[model samples]
Target: MRQDRKSLAWSTLLEIDSQPEGPLHRKLCGALRSAVVAGRVTPGSALPPSRVLAEDLGCSRWVITEAYAQLIAEGYLEARSGSATRVRATAAVPNQGQPRSNPQISVPVEFEMLPGMPDLRTFPRKRWADAVREVTASIASADLGYPDVFGHPRLRERLAAYLVRGRGAAVSADDVIVCDGTLDGVVRLCRALRSAGHTHVAVEDPGWSRLSSAVSTVGLTPVPVEVDRDGLRIDRLRANTLTRAVIVAPAHQFPTGTVLTPARRAELLHWAREVDGLVMEDDYDAEFRYDRRPIGTVQGMDSARVVLMGSLSKTLSPALRIGWVVAPPRWAEALREAAVAVTPPPVIDQLAFAAFLDAGWYDGHIRASRLRYRSRRDLLLKEMASTLPDLEISGAAAGFHLLLHLNDCDAAQAVRRAARLGLRLVDLDQYRMSARTGPPALVLGYGNLSDASVPEAVRRLAEAVRGKGTGTSCG
Candidate 1:
């Protein structure tokens, strides 16, 4: 069989005899340097071994070594003892002051008001490092092997206890399955439901677009159920019995930020029981409530019919990719099979998180973050009150964002205008499944902004809405 491009490229040897410009080693060095500069060989790609290259070129190994050494001395390549010699990271072919034939253009963003983003600046790095070091020193050698796929037993136990106490989740260590992230858990849940003969899954009409896309990608239809002030309309859900599952963010509904009332919660749970359907409860951002008591999860009420998914994406950084799915004991086998279909997250992080939780660092971080975000929420309310008094906001009591109901203005037009003024904003109409429904609104996220910039960004938004001139700069 023909070799691959990378292997064939590496196997090529310099023809020293044909090139009479300089010594054999010099010629070899020139050829390799030219290849690197011309971009034929990419940076960080390993070259053939000196012995193999010399044998192929009918030269002594010392000659190849000398040429490689020269290239390394000239900063064209990198070499380390016992490791393959490779091109340097900055070895890309020079543009020589000439613009590329097809230059890619990039637009810079100034202020980002996108929702569901946590204040990454508040992540306790020192505490996390300590937890990781402690866990690494204490973890067993055997625990480093392939993880339990479901989750590490210690971490699962820790999470089960934490959720039960903090989030009001009804689960035990045996009923939990660790996942790469919330999206991973959702995908797995959908596939498992599909395997169990579910063809339709209901989602809120003005819900996260990615949720619907995930359902469609897994070969199941997404039934769009309208959401009211009280939250997902239980009556509409009752009208559709074929929908096998419904996903919700009840604690703090996305974009709109409405909490599911007690009546609606009970009605939805009763509906699930009657239809024999599942409720995928996404307890998104339930940790940062500022006004009221943290809403209890539906899973706490009926674990058998509810599969709760929560992640570090909101409370912690999304880059950690740590989340869990707490299911009923009967679905444990199905969830496990679903988990095996996808690669689990790194075991070390799982263990480190267990240590963090066990040491109470996780709870400490939550408390501190709650206070920090609450301050930001207060700042946002204060700024909006002064700049845009007519702006109606909701869902400020919980989560990192608030819902701005736009009156007498187009949400899409406002978004475009705000973007031109260097403010990144999202409107509610973008989240709808069909044509724009109800009144227009905006979901403003303040988690990523500093205290000083929050007021400026909102002021720019107000100016954009009022047809005033653009701001000076994004800063």
Candidate 2:
């Protein structure tokens, strides 16, 4: 019996008793059949018990039983002893003049160069499962109730220590606030800014759209600040007097992968201090640097002016939804107040993550992931150099993605044609807030791409670029 629909109080079913034209059982049967045929009652839906329906419809139990039996004989319903009666799986009629067809399930592309996705195959399932099991077995009864508005204390302490030790951020456990992920942290920060009388937030011109969207969602306008080889142009940001707060990925900027130069970093902090503004540092994928040692965070230098945001989305898995915000002392209270409005991630998961960190599993996982991704990046660079030598590539020094500058080539058209060739690619223009003109480019991500698929994927990409064929192949 489908418990969900067993107590269904369908008006049509109850209305049969008011029908004065035919016998009670016959009327009930006709109404039920019409309901099923008309799609009022969905297929596989449980009908009410005979006694319940009889009492509700003011009819004898035998009448309800007789109608149910008749429907079963007509192949409109099914019944088993000791179970509730249910509509036949195929009893519902199709719409007039329409033929039934199987539901469509979308097939994924064989080779996807989607930016910001980590390879899911490497997730430490056993370790994570063990941590969860251990935490569940040993967690205190009091910890199972409502979570702390800021975060679980143990997780916050672990995150604070980890961030300071790894990312070089200056923060204590009191400054840490756990969030669902980077985007959730962004939203909470935006709301806090709005509450603090902020009207505009400066964002990177060609930046992650979802983060900018989060800014706009909180009723604060996102001012686009151009990013260059040195990272966010400090002079361009200084020009916008109305915008005080800015979000930046200093360790490795997205799309371009340019690290924020020390000079620009100093200038950014200066600007923040001058205006008493905040700098939201999105330290995403900072741990995966391949060419050199990852730069220490801006918050490490000036913790008072910066809010360091990081998460396990890249280092571990997005499914965990574990992220933290190291807020400045001035904004910590406001962010905590904003945190109350959003439901924090599960406390058990938080504790499990703390256990993972405390056990040094997180560090081990990051080291292994860095090696794996670096190999993939090297393979992709080599293939591109061998096949598409004429095409210029940038941002290959670090991170899961790199930029393929399509000089004079139409990136949008290339993406469309690539789709026809069973290749997935993203255009750089999609990330731009303004219609700035430059050589078009594609943001190619090789994180989730398998090593065995690299040669064929690059070959297909070459075909798409060369306008060779229109036929689609997943080879």
Candidate 3:
């Protein structure tokens, strides 16, 4: 039985010897031929030079040369001119997920304005790195062992303090459960709600698709209530036969970027109260508002019903991988219970973040980032108006994203063309929970781009909308 190439390659290779009774070269060639036949030398592999093989075997180079010649004649090796002997081409190998040689070419324009990405360059690296090193040094080895299921206590404390001032949310460190991000925090909330007898959750129709996914991830059906400029229609909650929770982006609605009006906020609170339900407020980008005063959170007014979630992913960097779930006092224990054994945010990051806040670096960065994003946003709007004056944009007053309504245009087609041209923007319809029966649109994020990148990116985007190619990733 012939050995396999992989196995034979590992052991002693057969070689011709002295003290030959029959021709040693012939015997060596026979062994080499068998090894090659047994898949030893893999096709197209170069044989060791005769001299090297002869030295190893302590035999004449002729012996090794003759042996290699046998394999070459037996179709195991291809000795082509100007090419090292290589394994013959075979059918596709067993390797999976092998990337094709062809890849998308680099371009100067990108069409996809991907949401949820922060301007990472603005991260206070020196401060954050110093904080990380400090926290890593200060925290005990036990702290590194496993996170306290819910989250780091110090981080929760800092977050509670920060949110109380920034968003008017009343939360103690104990009421906070640190999770991976807003999505995971919402998922944790949904699991808790479902565990407590909820079967359905109300979400804004044309809502953030993620809200629906978060609701559904825990086995509950998503009851997508309608959303208008005022936000989710609270009046329709009673009509929802199964809803016990509502997920909302009150500060700046996703894709639309409209603040939930004060009147609507009150109304929704009333609806949640009436049904003995809950409101999951995703404060996605409330920190970067440019319009009216920062949108006051509904949680500050009524903490018991609102599971307010927020993350620094936009304010700082998502790579830090920290988010908070400020739950009602009643749910804290269970939320922590769920968190205790789950994937907690890394302790070092949490500690580093706590120290970062302690150092007052995050605030400074936020101030700088706010100015930068505002400039980029203004440039985007300016360039869009100059290039495509007829195009409509909404959600401009605040938030990092703008909903671009290319009137009577094909949003997906434009997105595809832009992607081919190397743009990294998303079509507005892509974020919709249900089919958008209205004007086709795209989502433009200006938060990450620089002032210079903004105008050119949007102009190229406008070009893409005009059926011209724009293939660079925006920013």
Q: Residue 81's C-alpha lDDT in candidate 3?
A: 26
Residue 331 lDDT in model 2? 90
Q: What value of lDDT does candidate 1 attain over all alpha carbons? A: 0.78
Tens-digit lDDT track of model 3 for 196-304: 8988888777766645644543556777677777877777766876787888888888877777888898988888888888888989788878765676789998998
- Mark the regions of model 2 whose C-alpha exceeds 4 Å error after superposition: 1-108, 470-475
lDDT of each: 0.78, 0.82, 0.70
lDDT of 2 by residue, 336-382 (tens): 76665566889999999999999999999989888899999989889
The segments of candidate 3 whose C-alpha lies over 4 angstroms from its true place after superposition are: 1-112, 468-475
TM, every model: 0.76, 0.77, 0.75
How big is the positional error of residue 64 in model 3, measured in Å on the Cα after superposition?
58
State the weakest 10-residue window (summed lDDT) of model 2.
99-108
Q: Give the CA lDDT, 0 to 100, for residue 293 in model 2.
A: 76
Ranking by lDDT: 2, 1, 3
